[model samples]
Target chain A: MAQAPVTTRGRGGRAGTWYLFLVPALLLYSLFVVYPLLTGLSYSVFSWKGTVRDAFVGVDNYVGLFTNEAFRSKLLPALGHNLALFAGTMLVQNTMGLAFALAFSRARRGKRALQIIFATPYLVNPLVIGYLWTLLLSPTFGPANTLLRAIGPDELAKPWLGDPSTALPMVILITTWQWVGFPMLLFSAAIGGIPAEYAEAARVDGASSWRVFWHITLPLLRPAIGTITVLSFIGSMNTFALVYALGGSSGGPAGSTDVLGLLFYRAAFASGDINAVGTASALAVFLFTFIFGTTILLNRILRQGEEAM
Target chain B: MTPRRGAVMVPLMLWGYALVAMIPLFVMVLGSLRPTQDLFNDPIGLPNKLYLSNYTRAWTEASFSTYVLNSVVVVTGAVILGAAVSVLAAYPLGRRKFTGRGFFIGYFISGMTLPGHFGVLPLFYLLDGLNLVDSRLGLMLVYAAGSVPFNVFVLSAFFRQLPGELDEAAALDGAGPFATFRHIMLPLVRPAIATVVVFQFVPLWNDFFYPLVLLRDESKLTIPVGLTHFFGRFQNDWGTLFAGLVMTTLPLVILFGIATRQIVAGLTAGMNR
Candidate 1:
């Protein structure tokens, strides 16, 4: 389409009104987002006691984040937990989500109900999801334990969230259950978009269903897979409300479910001191850099994969 | 991908997963309906009788009524503020071919995927300095700002797709740019705006982190944050909490059920299309 010439937009001076239209959203967005982003960078290098900055600390806060025992202990483990959560989603969320998507796309009946059912868990607050699951997984007066006891041994009904080893995994599964709907919808739509001819032709060639899925369906889903992977990575990394609800702000049961967002909260607000603010700011900056860089790298890889396909 | 033939196991697996997935929610509904005593005494058994008191208790004693009101107010305000500004901004970028148009579009688009949580400290201080930290209007502003990127992104793309004859026809009819936009263009983009709102509603409604840290007053808190405090206060009232949870989630579920097709379309709008 040819560009609409400027003079055609208005009789004479009215063309400038477009700039007027841009101001409200731009001002709100800039003041809230662009400005703080810059300030966050500067704040990372300075000590702040609540709203007041006390001293400039160069890279000391960043250094301290990696060195200070107070943060170092939590930071590494939190990072590990984030990665573990990502891995778990890659396993559980991806596989189940794809299966659900495939099934939904194939089924001739109740597609609307299936979509709604799959989508319900994700519609509520993650915090609420955490709370609901907490009640379900409660050792006493919880149906999950009762069912486990009746179906298996009494030992099978052990506290799900109370134990350290199980806490993180439980959180991961709950996270998966809450989020799988969205990616599933995406996958289902993508699968639906694929022309049936490719798979039909493959079937005519006597290819097994697995063979057709592997070569035709999976290859066609490369973009969706890449997009979901990147999004899931970011989602897991930024997770806080779920962890905060299931485990306390400390990410407890022994800090087994601790993650970067919680660590940021704990560091920033724990003392409300100037140095703590600086340290938290430093961590934020680091997280920003890490996430931004990795996403760029991932985008590049995705583009390359698409081109290769 | 469709296979000509499939095993019975596939449908069985799907149905099994669906049933298992519904268990937690079913349990929540049952817990809400039955008495707390029944919940504890007959953990795995049927409810002896229906007890509607849990909903009333949660509504009155737990203060979820006020919290829901606050949530509705904030979410509606944010959606309006976000949508209004986005529509205005998108028109200029989408319809006009002025200088630095690309720059402005790029600026809004840059924030599309950047999570704004990392700037909490700075943002808090920014709002505090502006005296907006604990205010409802402040929360609305923050939510609005957070949504601008996505709203502008989608809305602008929508605006760009309109036929150029629209502007020409409006211009010939002696309508100025603003008048044209208000009368002609606005009516056309209603579906896109609705789509944006539907897409924005879920995240905005479900957001907990920002409201928790930003708002301080008890009555001012939204449902998610308020529910946490309610849980703390009524630690052992599992039935009441379940009622609160159902109250919080049920309306949304019902809404989605009614508008399932539109919601699904809005959600999958970013996919292969």
Candidate 2:
């Protein structure tokens, strides 16, 4: 890893060619990714509507995003829904994912078929998946209602996506269904990478299965857990297409399924009022800050938890 | 984590979840084969006769044919443009010890963290100003640009794994840097390039956001966007809708079935290692 002397570079003149190689990617990335981000930050301050800048309103847009009643009622609850998604998925999906990983790691029967079948859902488009679930969960003609009725739980066969009380939970479960394989695979890889010797040694010491998992396996899987948490958390926070496809931009079923991404879209595009652009930009900035800050905070907390263990 | 001695519940649980995953897909396929009335009455049952009219209706009346063609074009364009650029960029970053190499690598990896909503409005204006709005080429550009960071990130890592001796040998034989990349280095990293393509292809084909915002023309819509419009019009036709979903998703399902290992490895490549 030692650096070669700078004199080596001066004689070669290959540095120019190296920069040539970097330019295409650098230019494309800056144009689409970096430049737009910086532009969005600046646009959050001004009273602009699409292309026209009206005035330098300073931080008024940010202030309005908080103080405005319409924005508040939608934004705050939408954020809550996102948190609900994160919590629900963590409890159900990750737990299932870990269980599947453990099962696949141990089971001798149908492992490959199970892996392929489990992972298939993650391969399709999220929008398509949302639409498919919308059909499956339809109250009148959907199979879910039929199955529930057949199982003697006729009361359980309600309009899953149409009722405000159930819409968010249904959407959350659908989201979990699409992505459980991701965490399963991630945990499987991490679990697979654990040295067999460590587990063998623990077993030789007469450690019970439950005690071994609690003491050795879970602690060693801290990094994987941390990764899945941060990823699943932020992913839910920024989710758009699933809710948009299933519930529409208004976060339908009377906005029970409302999320920040849909809120941003409704603010920016659905309202048709141009001045809402600045407010939407402000919301975007808030979302960016929240995602970035929480990622850093969660990673730090996970690191500390690892150290404590 | 070791496999514990108590294995019965975990395996049963895994199989149960696997069934949960497969059942919906099974329903989708089965429902697609029935007429609308049959599906309405007997959604969970197998079709009495395989009705093929729903596929034709979805293809012709729903206009998924045009959408599929458009998606194929955009996905092909974006994957090729992105892969070519990534190869060129990853080569220098991975092979040479240039000034600002770390900075360049960091610059590319940073794209992974960007939120989609953050700059979408600004990007809309940017594309509009450039007069690329409502055009396939414009959408392709956005797709290619958006994909560059991850492609460069993955490909550069793959490129770095090549032995330095190969580059030295190529240079010793009077292969210029460009020639070394085009002839010597590119062949060694074909698998990574395929990884980049497979990774990029699914998202691009599945993309609805860019086409929703940028392409206003009906002729230019991708499958996701196109299907939404079709669904809105034929909201009551459950059979046709199911057929449309199957056709739209079948290619990916087939691809995954054929290359499950490659797709999974390509996807989880950076996550673990």
Write down the C-alpha DockQ for each prediction. 0.55, 0.55
Tens-digit per-residue lDDT, A1-309, candidate 1: 443543454536676788899999999999998888878899988866666788887998899988988678889999999999999999998888998898876787767777767767877778888888888899987788988998998889989999999999999899988888878887997999999999999989999878988999999999889989998988888999899889988898999999999888888777555577788889999999998888889889988989986
Question: What DockQ would candidate 2 receive versus the native complex?
Answer: 0.55
lDDT of each: 0.85, 0.84
lDDT of 2 by residue, A1-309 (tens): 322432254237766878888788788878877898899988889997555888999999999988989779888999999999999999988998897897788788888788878977887788888889999989999998889989976898889899998888888788888988889988998999998788789889998777877888888999999999999988888788888889887889889999988888788877776777799889899888888898999999999999997
Q: Write the per-residue lDDT of candidate 2 for residues B1-273, one digit (tens) a residue.
A: 344535667777777888899899889898889999988878688988869999999999989899999989988998999889888999877766767889988888888767654788888889888998888888888889889888888888888788767767666687777887788888999988988888788778887777877887888888888988988988899999989999989988787767666676676776654
Q: Give stretches of model 1 more than 4 Å off.
A: A1-6, A9-12, A102-112, A193-217, A302-309, B1-6, B258-262
Quote each prediction's TM-score: 0.92, 0.92
Second chain TM-score per prediction?
0.94, 0.92
lDDT of 2 at A66: 85
